[model samples]
Target chain A: MSKHLLTIIDYGMGNLHSVAKALEHVAPNFQVEITADKARIAAADHVILPGVGAIRDCMAEIRAQGVDTLVRDVLASGTPFLGICVGMQALMHSSDENGGVAGLNTFPGRVHCFPKDALDVHDLPMKVPHMGWNNVYQQAEHPLWQGIESGERFYFVHSYYVEPQPAYTIGTCHYGPEFAAMVGRDNLFATQFHPEKSHTAGLQLLKNFTDWNGRL
Target chain B: MPLAKRIIPCLDVDRGRVVKGVNFLNIRDAGDPVEVAKRYNEQGADEITMLDITATHEGRGTMIETVRAIAGQVFIPLTVGGGIRTVADIRAMLNAGADKIGINSAAISNPAFVREASERFGAQCIVVAIDAKRVDDHWEIFTHGGRKATGINAVEWAIRMQAYGAGELLLTSMDRDGAKSGFDLALTRAISDAVSIPVIASGGVGTLEHLAEGVNLGHADAVLAASIFHFGEFTIADAKRHMASRNIEMRR
Candidate 1:
C-alpha cells in the first residue's frame, strides 16, 4: 500500500489537532501533518483546510502564512482538496461574520449569517451558531460521498452558512433557510460541518478523500 | 430530515477515571473514561461530555491528559467541564481535543468569563452547565457539585447565560439526580423555552421513555444520562432506538 501525505492546513485558527487525529484514525496509510508551510502543503497528495473561531482571525492567519494563495494554487492543480467550516467559508468572496469580512474569493459567493428569525423545522427559533448535528442532503453524486448515504447527519458549529453559486452546491441543509452543506467542483470539496467531529460518516468521507485520485 | 436531538453520555471523571454517584457523593468506579467514551462513540452517541469531577487546580493536568486520551480514541465531539474556570482552561481542553468547553461554577462566579470565553473561542464552543434544584416553586442554581446553593434562579440564570453568549446549556436537576425519576421536564422546558440556544437535559434519566421525554416533552435538544448508561442498564444505541420509536428525531 502506498502512503499518502495528508497535510491539514493549519492557519493557527482552525481545529488542527482533532482533524489531524481524526485523519490519522480513519486513513492509517495516510501520513498526516499539521503545517502552515506553503511548500509542504503544495507537495502533499491530499489537502484538508480546517478552521474554527472567527473568519476575520482565520483570514488574517491564512494570509499571514500565505495559505490562501497556496489554496488557490492547489485548486488550480486539480488536486484532491477538502475544506471544513470557516475553511469552506473562506473559499467564498466574503462573509457577514465579524461585520463583513473579505474571503479568498476562490468560489464566487457570499457567506450570510443565519437569520435571527430563522427557526428549525419545529418552528422554534434556532440558535445563531447552529451548533451540534444536522442533516446534509446530497445535491449531486460525487466520488467523496461514495460510501456515504444521502442526508447523513454531520456535526456543525457555525453562525454563518455559505450561499455558494447554484452550480457548485453538492449538498444542502436547513436551519433558518436551506443552505449548501457540502460543495464540490472537480478535485475540490468542502463542507459546512466538521467531519472530524461527525463520527462514522465523517471518517468515511476522510477515507474517500484519501482514496480519491483527483478525478471527477 | 431536520437536526436530530442529541443523546450524550456524560462521564463524570476524576483524575482519568469514570465515576458515578448521587448528588456528587458515594462515588463508584465505572471504568476507564477513555474506554467508556470509546464505547459510547461506537454505540452511536451523538456526543460525549467529560465533567472533570476533580476539576481542581492540581488535577487539571491529569484531566487534560484524560481528555487527550479520549479524543485520541473516540471520534465524536467531547465536552470537558468541571473546574474549567478560565479562557486558558478552555484553550487547554480544546487543545486537548474537546469540541466544546463546559463551564458551571466558574461562570456563575465571574459571569463575565462566559462572555470572555465566548468572545474569544466563539459561542459555539462554550457550554454553560447549570445544576438547578427546585426550591420553593422555583429552580435555584447550585455550585460546587450541587453542594452549595447559590440561590440563583434556574430559569432566570438560563436567560442570563444565554445573554452572556453561551451557545448551549446543560441543565441538570439536582432533585432528580441519580433518582431514575426522569428529567425535570418543567425545568427543562422552562429553560429550553426561555432561551433560543439549545438546552441539554441531564440527570435522572432511567428509562428509554425518559430519554424520549427529554425531547418530546422537556423540549431539550439533547439528553445526558449517567447511572442508566454507566451501570449497563441501557446502551446509547438502545436509548436512540427507544427515542426513535417514540417518534423523536434521532440520528440512527
Candidate 2:
C-alpha cells in the first residue's frame, strides 16, 4: 500500500508543529510534512492549512509565497483539505481582523469578530479570544464528524468566526448565539476550533479525515 | 461548558537533552527533547512546557536551536521559559517557534516587564512563572533559580503579576519540588484564588491522583510534573483516564 501524504501549509504565524504532530499521531503510517513549497503542496494526497495571528499577516504571507494559487489548485484537484482556527478563517472571502484583508475565498463567506454584546448578555464572563472548550452542535451530516457525537466538545481559541452561507455550514456553536463552527463542501472542510488541541475526540476527528473516502 | 483542566508535561532541558530530577536534585538524563516531546504528544499532552534550566548561568539567551529542533517534531503548544529577560528574548523564542514565553525571575525583577511583554505580544503569550518556597510558615517567592528568597508572599505576588498584565501563573512549590509526594494544595489554592488568569501548578506530582488533587483541591487549571513523567512512572494516558474517572474535567 502506498503511504498517504499530508502536507501542512506553514506561513509563519504560530504553532505549525502541533498540527503536524496531531496528524502523525492519528495516522502514523502517513507522511506529514510542514512545507511552504508549492510543488510539494500540489502533489500531496491531503492538504492542511494551519494559521495563527492577524488575518492580514496570514494573507500577506500566503500571497508572498504564491500559496494562494497553489492552495486553490490543490482544492481544484478535489483532494481532502482541512483548515484549522485562523486557517479556517483564511478560507473565506475576507476577514474583519485587519481592515478586511482578502482570503483564499475557497468558500463564499466573510469572517467577522465575535459579537461582544451577545457575550455580555449571556453572563458567560468570557473574554474575547474565547480561549477554551465549548460544545459544537452538528447542524448537518458530514464525514468529519464521523464517530463523533453531536454536541461533542471541541477546543476553541479564537475571537472571529467564518459566517459562510447556510449551504456550507455543517455545525454551529453558541458563544452568545449559534454561529458557524464547522463548514464543509465536497472535498473542503474547515473548523474554527483547534482539533489538535481538543484531545481524543479531536484525534478521532483527524483520523476520520485521513481515513475518509469523501463519502458523506 | 466548564473550562477543562489541562494535563501538561514539563521538560527540563539542559544543553539540549531533556532531564528529570526528584526534588530538583539528583537529576537523571531523560531523553532527547524532540523524542520525549513526540512521546508525550502521542500520549496526548494538552501542552508542553520547556524550560532551559541552565540558560541563565550559561550567560546566554534561551535555547532557540533546541526549541526549533523540537518544534519540528512535536506538534503541541510548546511554552518555553528560563532566561527570558527581555522582549527581544521573547521575540526570538516566538520566532524559534514557541507558542508562549514564560518569564519567572525576570518578571519578578521588573514587574513592568510583564506589562511590556504582554502589551507588545498578546497577553496569552506571557506566562509568569513563580518559584516559591515555604519559609517562616509562609509561601514566599524565590528567585535566582530557586536559590534565593524574594521575601514576598506567593499569593500577594501572584495578584500583583495579574495586575501587571500576566495572563497566567506557572506556580512551582520549591519545597514540594522533586519530592514526588504531591503539590502543595494550600499554596496552589492561594495563588489560584488571587488571580483570574489560569494557574498551572508545578512540583511534587507523583501519581494520577496528585494531578486530580492539584486541579480539584488545589484549584489549578493545569498540573505540570517532570520526574513522574520523565521517568515513565505514569503515562499521560493513564493520568487522564484516572482524572476522568474521578470526575475531573480533562481531555480524555
Candidate 3:
C-alpha cells in the first residue's frame, strides 16, 4: 500500500495533538504531521483543520499564517480536507461571535450562537456550549458515515453552530433546535463535533476519512 | 433525542499515581492514571476527569505527563483539575492535550483570572470547579481540597462564575465527597438552576441509583464519581443502564 501524508494544519489554534494522535491510531499507513507551513499543507495527501476557542481569534490567526487562502485552494483542488469545531465554523461566510467575524466562505452559511433564551425539550433552560455526547443524525449518506450508524453519539463542545445551505449539510444534531452537525461536498468534510475526542464511533469516522479517495 | 446526560469517571491523581480517599481523607493508591482512564474509556465512559491531587508544584509535571499519555490513546473528553492557578497553568494542561482545565481556588483568589483565561482560551475549555460545603442555611465555597472556607455563597459564586465566562461548572459537595451517601441534591439543584452553563454534579455517588438522582433530582447536566468507578463497584455501562431505566437519556 502507498503511504499517505496527512497534514494537520496548525495555525497556533485548536487541539492538534489529540487529533494527530487519533489519526495515527486509526491509520498506521498514513504519516501525520502537524504544521503551519503552507507548502507542507498544500503538498500533503490529506489535510485536517482542527480548531477551538473563539472564531475571531481563529480567523485572525488563520489569516496571519496565510492558511485562509491555502485552505480554500486545497479544498478547491479536490484534496480531502476535514475541519473540526471552530475550524468547521471558520469555513462559513460569517459568525455571530465576538461581535461578528468573517470566515473563509467555503460554504454559503453563517454561524450563529444558541439563543440566549434557548430551552431544551424538557422546557428547562438549555445551556450554551452544548458540551457533552449528543446524537448525530445523518441527514445525507456520505463515505465518512461508513461503518458508523446514523444516530451514533459524538462529543460536541461549542456554543455557536453553522447554518449551512441545504446542499452542503450532510448531518444534523439538536441542542436547542436542529443545527448542522456535519457539512461537506465531495472531498471536503467538516464537523462541529470533535471526532478525535469521540470514542469508538468517532474513530470509525476518522478511519473512513483516511480510507476515502476524495470521490463522491 | 436531546443531549444525553453524561457519566464521567474521575481519577484523583497524586504524584503520577491514581489515589482515592473517603471524604478527601485517608488517601489510598488506586492504580496508574493512564491505565485507569483507558479502562474507563473502554467501558463506555462519556468523559474522564483527572484531578491532580498532588499538592506540590513539581508534581504538576507528572500530571501533565499523565494527561498526555491518556490523551494519546483514550478517545474521550479529558478534564484536568487540581492546583490550576494561572493562565500559564491552563495553557500547559491544554497543550498537554487536556480537553478542559478545571480551576478551583484560583477562581476564588482572583475572580478576574477566570475572565482572563476564558477570554484567552475560550469558554468551552474553561471549567470552573466549585467545591461547596453546607453551612447552616446555605452552601459556602471551600478551597484547598475542602480544607479552607472562602465565605462565598456557593449559589452566588456559581452565578458569578457564569457571568465571568465559565463554560461549565464542576460543582462538588465537600460534605458528600466519598461519603457514598449520594449527592447533596439540594446543593446540586441550587447551582444547576442558578447557572445557564452545564453543571457536573460531583461527590457522594455510591450506587447506580445515585447517578440517576444527580440528573433527575439535582438537575445536573452530568454526573461524576471517583470511588464507585475506580474501585470497580460499578462500570460506566451499569450507570448508563440505571439512568436509562430511570427514563434519563443516555448515549447507550
Candidate 4:
C-alpha cells in the first residue's frame, strides 16, 4: 500500500478526517495525505475531492488556493480520481445554490435543487437536503462498481443534485424521479453518496478505488 | 434517491465510557466507546451518535480520544454531542474526526450559536439535539441531558432551530428515554412536520416494531436507540429488515 499515495484534496470546506480515516482503515500502509497543495495533489498516485460544506465556498477556496486548475491537471493526468458529495457537485458547470454560483465546469451540466414538491412513492415529501442512507443503483459495469451489487444503499447528505450529461452518468437514483447518483468515465468516479459514512457497501467502494487502475 | 430511513446507535458516555441510564438516571456501564462504535458500524448503522453526558460541566477531553479512535476504525459518520457550546468547541470536535457536531444546551442558551456555527461550518455539519418530555398537554424541551426544563415548546423550537440553519434535529423524549416504550409519535410528528430538516426520533425504543413505528407512524427520518442496540437485544440489520417488511422504505 505504500506504493499508492492517495491524496485527498482539502479546499478548507470538507469534513476531511472521516474520509481519510476510512480510506486508511480500508487499506492500511497506503500513504494517505490530506492536503490543499497542488504539487502534492498532482504528484499523488490517486486524487480524491471530498467536501461537506457549501459548493460556492468550496469552489471559491479551490480557486483561491489556485487548486481549480490543479484539479483539472490531475484529471487530465488520467490518474484514478474520485469525488464525494460537494466534490462531485463541484465538477459541474454551475449550481443554483447561494443565488447561483459557478462550478469548476469540468463536466457540462448544472447542479439543480431537488424539486420542493418531490415525493417518494409513498407520498412522503422528498425532503430537501436529502440526508440519510439511500441506494446507489449502478448504471454501468465499471471498476468502481466491482464486487458491489446494484441497489446497495450508500449514505447521502445534500439538497442539490447534479444533472450531468447522460454519457457521464454511470449511476442513477430516485427521489422524485431518476437523477445522477454517480458519474464516471475512464479513470474518474464521483459519487453523490459518502462511501466513508456507508458501512459494508461503502467499504467495498473504497477498496475498489484503491485497486482500480483508471481503466473502464 | 429516496432518503432511506436511518438507524442510528447512540452512545451516552459519562466518563470516557459508554453508559446507559433510565431517563438519564441510575447509570450502568455499557462498554468501550470505540469498540461499541466499531461494532455498530460493521453491523450497518446509518450513523453513530456519541453523547458525552458529563462534558458540559468541566470538559474532560477524554471523548476527543474516544472520537479519534472510533473514527479511525469505524469508517462511518460520527456525530458527537455534549459540552459543545461554541464555535471553537465545534471545531475541536470536527478536528477530532466527528462528522457532525450536536449542540444542545448551548443552542438553548443562545439560539444564535447555531446560526454562527452554520455560517462558520455550514448547516450540513450542525445538528441540534432537543431533549423533550410531555409537560401538561404539550411536549416541553429540557436541557442538561433532560434534567433542566427550558419551558420552551418542542415543536416551535424545532422550527426555530431549522430557521437557525440546523441541518438536522435529534428529538429525544425524556419521559420515554430508557423506558423503551416507543417513540413519542405525536411529539415527533409535530416537530418533523414543522421542520423540513431531517428529524431523528430518539428515546423509548423498547422493541423492534417501535423502531419501524418511528419512521412509519412518527414520520421521523431516522430512529436512534442505545439500550436495544447496546444490550444485544437486536442488531441494526434486524431492525432494517423489520422496517422493510412493514412496507417502510429502508436500506437492508
Candidate 5:
C-alpha cells in the first residue's frame, strides 16, 4: 500500500501553521506539508485548504499565489479533498462577505452572512461573529460521519455561511436557522466549523476523512 | 437549548513543558505542552488554557514563541495567560495565534488596563483571571503569583472586573488548587452568580463527576484543572464520558 500524502494549501490569510501542526500530530506517519506550490498540490493524494479571516483577503491571497488553478487541477484528478472554514466558503461560487467576492466555483452555491431574523430570541441578544460552540444537525448520512453521533456540537467562529444545494449538504447547524455546516459530493468534503477545534468528535471526523475509501 | 458547559484542561507552562503542584510546590514534569494540548484536543477539551506561570514572577515577556509553537500544532481555541500587562502584549499574543489573552495580577493592580484593552481590541479578546484565597472566613483576591493578599471579596471583584470590560472570568481557588478534592463550590457559585459574563471555575477538580457538579451546582460555565490531567490521572475523554452519562450537556 502506498503512503498517503496530505498537502494543506496555504494562501497567507490566517494561520496555516496550526493546521499543519494538527495534521502532523494526528497522523505523524503521513506526509504533511504546508505549501503554496502548485505542482505539489496537484501531485498530492489528498488536498486540504484551510483559511481564516475575511473572504476578500482570503480570495486575494489565493489569486496572488495562483492556488486556484492548482486546486482546480487537484479536484479534477478526483482525489479526496477537504476545506475548512473560509476554505469551505471558497469552494462555493461566491461569498457576500467583503462586498461579495467570487470563489473557486467547485460547488454550486453562494456564501452569505447569516440573516438576523433566523436567529432565536435567546440568541438575538448574542454578539456578531458567533464565536463559540454550537450544535450541528445531520442533514444526510455520509462515510465521513460513520462513527459520529447526531447533534454533536462543533467549535464555530464565523458570521458567514455557505448556502449550497440541499443535495450537497451532509449536515446543518442552527446558529440562527438551519444552515449548512458540512457538505460532501463524491470525493470532496467541506465544513464551515473548525473540526480541529471540535475536540474528540472533530478528530473522529478528520480520522474518518483520512480513512475514507472515496467510494461515496 | 441552554449554553453548554465547557471542559477545559489548563497547562501551566514553565520553560516550555507543563508542570503542576499544590500551592505551586514540588513541581513535576507534566509533559510537552504541544503534545498534551494535542491529546486534549483529541479527547474533547472544550478549550485549552496555557498559563505561563514563570513569565510574570520572573519579569519576562509573554510567551509568544511558545504560544506560536503550540498554536502551530493545536487547532483548538488557545488562551495564553501570565506576564500579560499591556495592550501590546495582548496584541502580540493574538498576532502569534492566541484566540484570547488572560490577565491576572496586571488587571488587579491596574483596573483600567482591562477597559483599555477591551476598548482597543474588543471585549471578547480579554479574559480576567482571579486567584481567590480564604482569609478570616471571607474569600479575598490574591495576586503576585498567589503570594500577596488584595483584601478584596472574590464576588465583588468579579463584578467589578466585568464592569471594567472583562469578557470572561477565570476564577481560581488558591486554597484548593491542586488539592484534587473537588472545585470549591462555594467560591464557584458565588462568582458565577455575581457575574453576567462567562465564569471558568479553576482549582481542585479530581473526578469526572466533580466537573458535572461544578456546572450543575456551582453554575460554572467551564472547569479548569491541571494535576488530574497533567499526571495522567484522568483523560478528557473519560471525563466527558462520565459527564455525558450523568446527563450533563457537553460537547461530545
Candidate 6:
C-alpha cells in the first residue's frame, strides 16, 4: 500500500509541531512533513494549514512565503485540506484584527472579535479568546466529522471568530455569541478549534480526516 | 452548551522526574513525567500541567526533553510552568509541543516582561501563574514556590496581569496548598471576578466535592491538583463525575 503524503504548511507562526505530531500519531501509515517548500506542499495528497497568534502576522508570512497563492491553488485542485484556528480565520474575505486585513478569500466571510464585554447566557462576563473546551454543534455532515457526535467539545483559543456564509458552515459553537466553529466547501474543511489538543474526540477527527477521500 | 470547566492534573518535574510535595515541602517521587501525562490523558484529564522545578541550568535541558517526550505521546493540551523566564524559554517550550507557558516569579519581578512576552508571542499562550498566601485581611502574592512573599495583593496582581495581556491566570493558594482541605473559595472568586480572563484555581483540592466547589462556588474556570492525582487517591473521571453531579459542565 502506498503511504499517503500529508504536508503541514510551516510559515514560522505559532507551534505547528504539535499539529504535525498529532497527525503523525493518528495516521501512522501516512508521511507527515512540515515544510515551507511550495512544491512539497502542492504535491502532497493531503495538506494542512495550522496557525496561531495574530492573523496579521500569519497572513503576512503566508503571503511573503507565497503560500497564500499556493493554498488557493491546492484548494482549487480538489486536494483534501484542513485549516485550524487562525488558519481557518485566514480563509475568510477579511478580518478585523490589526485594524483590518484581507484574507485569502477562499470563502466569502468576515472575521470579527468577541466583544470584550461579551456576556454569557448566565449573565457572567465571557472571557475573550474563549480559551478552553466548548461544545461544537454539527451544522452539516462531512467526512471530517465522521464518528464525532454533534455537540462534542473541542479545544478553542482565540478572540476573533469566522463568520462564513451559512452554506459553508459545518459546525457552530456558542461563547458570547454563536460563531462558526467549522467550515467546509467542496474538498476543503476548517476548524476554529485545535483538534490536536482536544484529547479523544480530537484524535478521532484527525483519524477520520486521514481516511477521508474528499467526499461528503 | 457552555464551555466546560477544565480539570488539570499538575506534575512537578525535578530533573526530568515527576515529584509531588507535601505542604510545599517533603518532596516525593511519583513517576516519569511523560508516562504520568499519558495516563492523565487516557483517563480524560481536560489538560495536563507540568511544573519544572528543576533549579539548575543543566536540569533545564532535561525539562525540555521531558516536554518533548510527553508532547509526542500525549495528544492533549500540555502546560509547562516553573522557571519560564524569557521569550526564548517560552518559545523553546512551545516549540517542544507545550500548549501554554506559565510564568510565576518572572511576572512579579518585572511586570513588563509579561507585556513583552505577550506581544512577542500572542496572549493565548502566555499564562501568568500567581502564587498567593493569605495575610491578615487579604491574600499576598508569593514567588519561589511560595517560599517568599512579594507583599503584593492577589486580586490587584490578577488584574494587572490581565491588563498586561495574560490570556489566563493560574492562581495557586499558598495557604491551602497541600492541606487537602479545599480551594480558597474567597480568594478564587475575588480574582476570577476581578479579571475577565479565565482563571485556574490551584492548591488544596482534596475531595471530589472540592473540585466541584472550585468552579461552582469559587467561580474558577478550571481546577488544578497535584497530590490527590499523583498519589492515586482519585482519578480524573471521579473528579469530572463529581463536578458533573453538581451541574458543572465537563468535557467527556
lDDT, ranked from best to worst: 3, 6, 1, 4, 2, 5
Position B65, candidate 1: lDDT: 92
- Would you list the C-alpha lDDT of every candidate in the order shown? 0.87, 0.80, 0.91, 0.86, 0.79, 0.89
Model 2 CA lDDT for position A80: 90
At residue A94, what lDDT does model 6 achieve?
Answer: 98
Question: How high is the lDDT of residue A63 in model 2?
Answer: 90
Q: What's each prediction's TM-score? A: 0.95, 0.72, 0.97, 0.96, 0.68, 0.97
Q: In candidate 5, which residue pairs get closer than 3 Å at backbone N, Cα or C atoms, i.e. clash?
A: A18-B72
Model 1 docking grade: medium
Tens-digit per-residue lDDT, B1-252, candidate 1 = 677889999999887789998877899999998889888888899999999887779899999898898898788888989888877888888888998899988888899999999878878888999999998989999976678998888899999999999989999998998888899999998999889888999989879999899898898999999888888889999998888898888888
Interface RMSD of each: 1.6, 4.4, 1.1, 1.8, 4.7, 1.2
**Which residue pairs come into collision in candidate 4?**
none
Tens digits of per-residue lDDT for model 6, A1-216:
878899999998888889988998999999999999889888899999988889999999999999888888998888899999999999999999999999999889899988877775336788776988999999888888878999999999999998757899999998877899999988899999999988788999999888988767
lDDT over C-alpha atoms for residue B58 of model 3: 89
Kindly list the per-residue Cα lDDT of model 6 for residues B136-229, writing each as its tens digit.
Answer: 9899998777888778999999999999989999999988998989999999989988888999999998899999889888989999998889
Best by TM-score: 3
C-alpha lDDT (0 to 100) for residue B206 of candidate 6: 85
Deviation from native of the Cα of residue B36 in model 5, angstroms:
5.9
Model 5: per-residue Cα lDDT over A113-178, one tens digit each: 866554322223333355567787788889989788888888876768887589899888765555
Candidate 2 structure, TM-score to reference: 0.72
**Alpha carbon lDDT of residue A159, candidate 5?**
67
Candidate 3 lDDT over A112-203, as tens digits, reads 98987777644678988788999998889899999998889999999999985789999999887789999998789899999998989999
Estimate, for each residue in A1-216, the C-alpha lDDT of model 2 and write its tens digit.
978888998776556766776787789989999988878888888999887666777788889888788777877888898888878888898888867888888888898886755522114333445555668888889888889998887877676787757999998887665668899888889898888766667888999999876546
Kindly state the fnat score of candidate 6.
0.72
Return the clash pairs for model 2, or none.
A17-B75, A18-B75, A18-B76, B22-B178, B23-B177, B23-B178
TM-score of predicted structure 4, chain A:
0.95
